[model samples]
Structures are given as C-alpha cells and as structure tokens.
Target: EIVAAVESVLAPQRAGRLAGRKVLVTAGPTHEPIDPVRYIANRSSGRQGFAIAAAAAEEGADVVLVSGPVSLADPPGVNVVRVETAREMMAAVESALPVDAAVMTAAVADWRTEADSGHKIKKDGSGRPPALVLVENPDILATLGHHPSARPKLLVGFAAETDDLIANARAKLDRKGCDWIVANDVNPETGNMGGAFNTVRIVSRAGIEEWPRLAKEDVARRLVGRIADHFAGA
Candidate 1:
C-alpha cells in the first residue's frame, strides 16, 4: 500500500512517459574473491543504480535490476537479481535479454584472482606474503553494447573517474559503443562517486551535458526523463 501511494504521487510527473517499456539496470561493485575469506571490491553502495531502477519503475517501465553484492532492498515493482562476481553479473545480464534499454552502472572489477583458493591460506610466518595472480574480467558494458543479437536499442554505461572525467568518458563512449556515457569524478572530496549525492555529465554522440550536483534520486529521475524523451522520438 505504501509503495502504491508513492507510485500514485509520482504518476502525475511520469504518466504515459515510460509506460510498457522494459528497462535493465546493473548496480553495485562486484566482489572478486581470492580465497574463501578474502576478496576485492570497491566502495560503490549501488545507490545511484537503485535510484535509477526506482525512478524507471515510477515512470511505468518494467524494470530488471541486476545487482552486485549490496544490502539495499529491492525497489517496488522492480525484478532484482543479485550477483557477486563480474562473470556472474555478465551472465545474469545476458540471460535477461530483449529489453528496450540498459544502464550499466555497476563498478565492475577489472581483474579477478587467476585461481581462487577454495580454502583459506594461513600465514606461515615465513616473512613473505603470498603472491596473488590476477586476470582481467570481461567488460560487461562493452560486451552488451556490441552484442550482435538481443541488443537493447539504447545502452548506457557509467565511467567513474578520479580525473579527466570528460576525456575519459568520451574515450569510453567510443570504446564501449554505448549510446550514452554517464561520467562522474570519484575524487574523495566531491563524494559524487559513491556517496548519496552525485554530479554527472552525460556524453553522447551529439555532445556533452553537465548536470548539477543532486541527490542520486534526482539524477535518476532526470536521466529517466531523458530516456522517455528518446524513446518517444524513436
């Protein structure tokens, strides 16, 4: 009932905009395990992606949220699929095919343990730490963007950079072949990368557009509005 009330309130703002659309969104930081007790991951809290899923659902879209390991509760009317590793995330996303659009917001690990130790390795007190081998994980954004079949009409990727936000984002836009790239500086001072608030730039073939700092919810709403506009034109 509470969810319905909130949806009713948002309906005035989003009615007929995204109705019947199917939107796929990925969220959070993937965990790459080294051993049973050790792993590597990022600081992403998945707030932005979750906000996007919520906003899209509010706009009447059928939303599928493929999330990395996070504690966030699923949004109302959103189908949630939880994953831990980058490979798992990619597989889950591939299985949820034929969507109208997709947003790759998860901070996927670039590398993973070459060989994960099933058992925890104990310190031998040999005064030397064990060497860890790493292998690159598949780039989900690039794969989905360049998929030959079942490709979403519109695909979006997030580029979280500490510096050269625009340049790096533009380069990623070309490399990932996505329709839009959302770039944000993850500098600790800005708190836009993993914090509740975010300031991002949207890069497309047309050009770049900077958005003011706002709560993640607002950013999601604005982005979804843009998606609605594009879909309407298409």
Candidate 2:
C-alpha cells in the first residue's frame, strides 16, 4: 500500500498507455466572415472533439486542443487554444506540431469571403443581393498530412458525411494521407452533428471497424483506447 501510494503520488498521469506522449485535437466550427455582422458557420457543437481531448488527457497524453468558435469549457489537463476562423485554427494547429498523434475533427468552413466588409451592408431597396467573392480556406488536415517534416506519427482525420459515408472516408484517408479516418453520418436525421450521441467507424488500411451508437464521451474513450492499442502494438 505504501509503495503504491508513493508511485501514484509521483506518476499520477503515467498509469495509462499514452504516458509521455503528445496528442493534438481540433474541434468546433470555424466561422468565415462575410461581413462584420454575419459569418458562415456550421452546426458543430464541438462536443466530440472536446470529449476526445479529455479522453486523451485522461490517458496521460499531453493534449493540445486547438478549438474554433464554441461554447464548451476547456477540458481539464489540456492546453486549449481558441480561434474563430479557419486560418487562425490552422495557425494554432501548426504551432502545436510534432505531436505523436492528431485528430482533426473541426468542421472548418470550406470557403470565406475574399475580403471582409468593414461594415454591414444595408438593403438599398434593389431586388438583387450583394455579390461576395469567396476563396477556399486552408486545408488543415491535408497540410499536416502532407507536411514535409512535421507530420504527426499517427494522423487521423474525421469525415462527417451525409452520403457515401464509407466511400468518402476511404477517399479522404487516401487524399489526406492520414493513417486513419473516423467517419460518421450527420444526415440531420441522425442527430450526430450537434448531439450527445455518435455512431462512427474506423476507416484504415486494415479495414473498417464499426462501433455501436454510444454517447460522445464513450466514443471518445473507445477511440483513445484504439490509439493506445496502436501505440502499444496490440
């Protein structure tokens, strides 16, 4: 009992398989500004990503959570960096680089206004709407996956698709050059986008491993366990 107590006191976080490892997580929905008053955003509540960060931290991993605009509280034992736009999120993710693993779960807007309007535009009684040119946002996951020197050892990407779920995930795994892709259906009917429960599948070179519908927290724990297994050569 004395020895155990002493060990616990000394290495409280070292009891898990991910001890001494660093993990990166990106979460929430990046808002791309159209004007000073409005921006393009998604329905992502950042629940799954936050849960993943918490799970990773619980497993003794040094977790860096680069989150977008979200109302979620910072997970205990995690270094949280909050950003509003996709560019900002990309910068934050890059700054936390050289991690052992990364999970890109943030729902980043695909495009943004080419230029932010300094002020909100008012209707001039014309029947036509304003024309806002848009440009593609930086692809954070693909950038890291194709990084020349700083790619994570185990890069994982998430695919939240409404259709062609497995096919899209497989394509993303190849296109993103990531080790694994976690695919889920967010077809509005599934309620997985901003809900507490999730159903996901692990898509990898090995094959697909489907998981039962579970609470977001449980999904996070199981995913972290899989990550630990991969590191431990299970």
Candidate 3:
C-alpha cells in the first residue's frame, strides 16, 4: 500500500507527449426517433472511437469522450459523457470546449422526424404506412469548424464513404472546415463499420496519407502518434 501510494503520487509528473493537452472525442451512432418505440440509426460499434480515446488517454491527455448508445465499456483514464441524439451530442461537445484537439467520430443522423410520436406508431386497418417528415439535424462538425471562438487547435472529422473516398474527404475538409479528416470505406463488403480491422486514409489540405489495413487498436496508436507529432511541431 505504501509503494502503490508513492507511485500514484509520482505518476502525474511523468512527461507525456500530450500531458497538458485536452482532447474531445465523439463516438457511436446517434438515434433519431420516429416514435416512442422506433428510431433511425447508422451502423457503428464505437470500437474505433473508443480505441482512439484509449490511445489518447494513454498519452496522458485530459480526454472527454461523448458517446451515443453503445455496449462497450468506457476507456480507462478518460472522462466519458453519454448521449442519445445528435443534438445532445452537440451540446456535450460544445460544453467541453477550449480543448487542444477535437475528434468528431460519431455517425450522426443527418435528418430526424419533424415530430416524434409520443406513443408507439402502429398500422391501422387501412393497410397504409404512416408518413414521417424529416428535418435536417444540427451539423456538429460544421458548427465547431465555424465556431467564432473557443475552437480547438486541431479539429478532426471522420468520413465513412462507399465511393469516391478521397474526393469526398477533400470536399468534407473544405465544407466542414476541419483541419484533418480520417476517411474510410464502410461498404458492406469492407466490414469496417463494425469490424476489428480498418483501412484508412488521413486526408488533409497538404495531401492524403494512406495507411494499410490494421487492427483498430493499432490505428488508434498510429493516429495518436500523428497527433503527438502535430503538437510537437506546433
């Protein structure tokens, strides 16, 4: 007990690459409810994002991870905030401002029903399905990208695309105004959405850096290395 206490006291003095930096990460898929019983969501297991958070925390950054509904356990040495919808995610992200970096990895729903039904939606005897009106949800990345102030020094976004990967990532970099984008192919065949391995490209204004397929944990480590290099030079 005495040795453990001594080690704990001295641990904070260890100089890590991101020791004093603060980082914010968003993970998982937001649920857009249609009614009390049903919701719309994308394919996401939250593994990659959780891996990234774990990696960042390993480097000693003060990390805040905002996540949607997921079964994964929280990463060690990180502060986690749970959320359900895109709007709640936006709010949680905004509240964790003034960080050195922000990673938007959540697969947020683009549109939500104009009005969610309070009760379960059921079919009547008419054999006609109920119509749902959808409206655009808040653009979390864009909001942070164009934030008047309190924007993080490094803003990273993720793009899961089925086609035109680089082109789409480039467009998103400009449209969302983020510093970097981690692009990946999530086609059903690729199996990246919920798989253990991932193939990704790091897209920035400078150019694209293609990384060979790797385990989700290795990808996280490599990304954290890049982040450390970025701060080392900054």
The TM-score values for the models, in the order shown, are: 0.92, 0.94, 0.93
Off by over 4 Å in 2: 1-13
Put down candidate 2 lDDT per residue, 3-67, tens digits, no spaces.
99998878855668899899999999999888889888876999999999999999999999999
Estimate the overall C-alpha local distance difference test score of candidate 2.
0.94
At residue 82, candidate 3 shows an lDDT of 96
Q: Against the unseen true structure, what C-alpha lDDT does each candidate score?
A: 0.92, 0.94, 0.92
lDDT of 3 by residue, 188-220 (tens): 898888999999999999999999999999999
TM-score of model 3 (CA atoms): 0.93
Q: Which candidate leads the pack in lDDT?
A: 2
What is the clash count of model 1?
A: 0
Give per-residue lDDT, candidate 3, residue 148: 93
Ranking by TM-score: 2, 3, 1
C-alpha lDDT (0 to 100) for residue 74 of candidate 1:
96
Model 1 misplaced regions, further than 4 Å: 1-15
